[model samples]
Target: MAVRAVRGAVQVDRDDPDVIFDETCSLVLEVIRRNDLALDDIISIFFTMTPDLASGFPAAAARAVGLTDVPMLCATEIGVPNSMERVVRLLAHIQTDRPPAMVEHVYLRGAVKLRPDLVRERRPGTRGPGGSTATG
Candidate 1:
């Protein structure tokens, strides 16, 4: 098995703890699912949130999702002028046979805008502006 790093990020609606937990969980799960990873395969996860986000640590959301024994760390991203706000990013190290090129990096919500080259088409049934169904 080869060690690989998976990346993901989510844009939270606000600095509320609940929103951070929900979005962080969603982002973490998607990264795991897309990479066909088992929790046991994870080595560690490092999470960083934009300076504007102070509601809670993103690692707490991973714990809430049953990552009890995993080594996780959370920190504040370096403040960059005109950077995106309310963004939480994760870099997960895992053991996998898949080649690095095959790994799917998840960028959900407005975070997709951060990595247009890596963004896949939005899944169906996703909500769009004003709560309408998002369609390609």
Candidate 2:
């Protein structure tokens, strides 16, 4: 299997622990669902929270949903003037036969504007800049 990277983000209305945990889990699960990935296929996940979100660790939410053995990390997103607030983001590495072109990157809730260009929903047959194969 080839290693592929999946990216996603979600916006949280508040920094409350419950909200953060819920949103983080939802984001991770959606990524897995869209990519048709099993837990075993995930190599690791790196998460980040906008500086405004400080109530909890997004990685905890990941572990709560059966990624206990997978390596994960959490860090604060750099603070930029007027940047989107209270957002959680993740980059997951997975084993897959799909090429980057077929990979679907997700941006949900208020975070959609974070990466308008990468937010398109891509199905298995989709062709992106990476093109038709996993050659990269």
Candidate 3:
């Protein structure tokens, strides 16, 4: 099996903990759904968010959705001037039989603007993140 990294991000409307948790859950669920991944396929997940989203940790929100035993961490993104705000991003590593080119990358809500090229080029046989050819 190959280890593939699935990239995903979602922008929350505000800094409230509840909103953070809810949006994060949505992001994670969407990633899993789009990739057709099972729980055991996940190896670890790394979450990062803009410095402004301090109300909660995305890792904790992931745990609330049955990722409790998986290794996970949360970090703050570098505060670049005028960069996007309230965005929670995740890099989930998973064991898959699929080739590198078949992995899917997800971007939802406002975060979709971050990678307009991927959103626009997401049709079958297009390239996903890292220039991997996406079959989905």
Q: Model 1 lDDT vs. the true structure?
A: 0.85
Compared to the true structure, candidate 1 yields what TM-score?
Answer: 0.88
Please tell me which predicted candidate would have the highest lDDT against the true structure.
Answer: 1
Tell me the tens digit of each residue's lDDT in model 3 across 85-120. 999999999988878677767887788879875564
Choose the strongest candidate by TM-score. Answer: 1
Predictions ranked by TM-score, top down?
1, 2, 3
- lDDT measured at residue 105 in model 2 versus the true structure, 0 to 100: 84
Candidate 2 clashes between residue pairs 3 or more apart in a chain or in different chains: none
Better of 1 and 3 by TM-score: 1
Off by over 4 Å in 1: 121-136
Each model's TM-score?
0.88, 0.86, 0.85
RMSD of each: 3.1, 6.9, 5.3
Per-residue CA lDDT of model 2 for 1-136, tens digit only, reads: 8998999999998989999999888888878777888899999999999998898999999999999999999999999998888989999999999998988787777787888888664455643221231232
Q: List where candidate 3 sits over 4 angstroms from the true fold.
A: 120-136
Give, for candidate 3, the lowest lDDT window spanning 10 residues: 125-134
lDDT score, candidate 3, position 20: 90
